[model samples]
Target: MLSIVSIGLVGLPVNAQPLYPTPDPDVFYTPPAELAALKPGDVVRARKIDTGMYVGTEGWQVAFRSTNSMSKPVMGVTTVLLPIGVKNPPLVSYQALINSLGTQCNPSRSLFNGELQDAAGAMLPIGRGWAVSLPDYLGPTSAYGAARLSGMMTLDSVRAVQKVAELGLANSPVALAGYSGGGMATSWAAALQPTYAPDLKLTAAVAGGIPADLEEMALSLGFAPHPGFGLAFAAAMGLEREYPEKLPISDQLNENGLWFREFTHDACRRFLLFHGAFRNAEQMAASKSLMDSPVAREVLRQNSLRHFDGIPSVPVFMWQGRFDELTFFPPVAEVADRYCRAGARLEFRPYEIAEHMTTAVAGFADAWNYVEARFRGEPAPTTC
Candidate 1:
């Protein structure tokens, strides 16, 4: 069990933001005691939701059976949006960069919050008369940085959609796309698809601002509290949910770390950025460089796209900034090259003039074109 402690203001800012209902107590999001009986992608339950905020779109929140990082049976929730007039549309699983530790920040909840960027981003695909699925791929606990769990949730989300007859997406051609945290999920789904869910008709994947090495991103932080530390520490806290024994995050925290963990459990992306702006991982950890320890190395390796053995069976289009301050460019480039050499059909683009956030705008058009072509059954381009 993870322990909770108190931290005074000197440790970290105590922004006690109100928490929305977490998964366990929330009736709609809760899973049954044992999921072992169900197969991955099995629709556990589903309920229609209002998409009135987005004109001419119908939506539903689906809870589907999936596997956790440990390959244990688990349930995941995804929000599916259908264009009001489209028939037999192709499916696009858009993994939102849900870089938060709170269940309230999951796409299922955020998709309705027009204020959030990803909710608006989902609109582009829906406007194209495509079925869009925004999965809370982080699992029931909002396991933020657990990529394998996210990947399985992503692929299984596609399956859940196909099984829902009312959605009319039976066996529809599928394409996946995401940026940053979502990119990690998209890449992991690509790498794990062949063996994990090869039955689906996966066409292509678009991964931008990819963080290929989980450990690199986690350990690259300095001792000082900075703007980017929130994302990193959130990831560390997120991973703790998946591997509590191996990663004693709650147990290892000093006063500030304890405060961070508590505040983040109920916080969202915006709060994380503002609160962690002046803090770093060293402040939370008892052993300053604990992320470099052997246990952390092994756990991070298992979740990282760079260390994965297999590549996606479908074509891939990857884009990144030349100098990304957050998810660095070199690691992403290396993953692209490794995939190319492994006989994977890939197209890699680097926005030479862009930075982390700038790459999103600079690379959007090309990524859109790639997804469009794949949906049209056009041949995939290659830079390998």
Candidate 2:
């Protein structure tokens, strides 16, 4: 049940949740002084909050203990939303694709502000009386591209909720859901769950728009000035937060690259899309060949979702747009091939007309249905 968790709630409450974004306070997210003594899912503190979610829900902001890319203790925030009339509902950790370097972009804050990143993905589950967990899988610092850290936070968020006696979800069947950035986090959580947090009841994982390989994307992506290029640069900057010693942005960037950093440091996903609209990513760096170094390769390799020691312990449902601009389809197909060869239970769906952003809503039916079937204890279907 993964019921081994602790919670300390405060009387703090948001007075009429802001309709606009607000700064994420450090007081709730700061790691506890006694972090060394706490476990991964332990809730440091929780606050009751109001959310304008499409599905009627009662919400709470949970700050829980989770590990980072460096395997050090860190605190992350997740919003636990229960359907107003559901009782003892199954749980789904909805890892929204939060692609910004800004703190205000986190889902815990964004949802309350009436911004739904992929609410369509959660509608079906919540409609069928399923509890939803919105985790900031990138951690409180928004380590956007750190694969391992994102997964760890995802798994820990589930564990945090199972222990909340007030939520009444003890031993509930759990599923993981996300798109793009959230997809990367969902895949990693599936890979890491067997060994990391085996006590919980993990069912199926629904992820769309996952970037299978970062190292390949780094070396091969065209350097032409495009909106997509800005995303790549932003990911590199995000990676630096988790791997400062390895990425070394300040040391590697030229004058233009420095401005790119300042432009994106606190920028949200929407702003990041055009930060490099006229600037070339290759020219931004002091040395165009910086990504060719062995150190850089190793770092990217460590963070790529393409390579895993073994197949995930649980079933996975993956969907991607054939013409996805953010995360291409072939690499994802290659990963699917590997899983099929390994005899893992994977259902990979490729959309003919959907792109990166549209695939989440385009394939929401299949994704949520897969999760619902799992919750019903139905036999998992495979497309291997």
lDDT of 1 at 334: 82
The sequence of per-residue lDDT tens digits that candidate 1 reaches over residues 110-187 is 766542566776678887888899999888878877888889999999899889888889878889999888988998
lDDT tens string, model 2, 1-384?
Answer: 000000000111223111112246768867779986799999888887776646498888788999988888988889888889888999999988688777877887667554445656555677789988989888767777788899999999999888878888888899998888889999889878888888766999988888878877765564665557666766776776786655555555667766667767777676777665646666675554544456667777787777765577689999999987668788889888888887878999999854667787787778988999999889899999
Candidate with maximal lDDT: 1
Alpha carbon lDDT of each predicted model: 0.78, 0.75
361 Cα displacement, candidate 1 (Å): 1.6
- In order of appearance, the predictions have TM-scores of 0.92, 0.89
Deviation (Å) of 343 in candidate 1: 1.4
Error of 2 at 218 (Å): 1.5
Considering only N, C-alpha and C atoms within 3 Å, which residue pairs clash in candidate 2? none
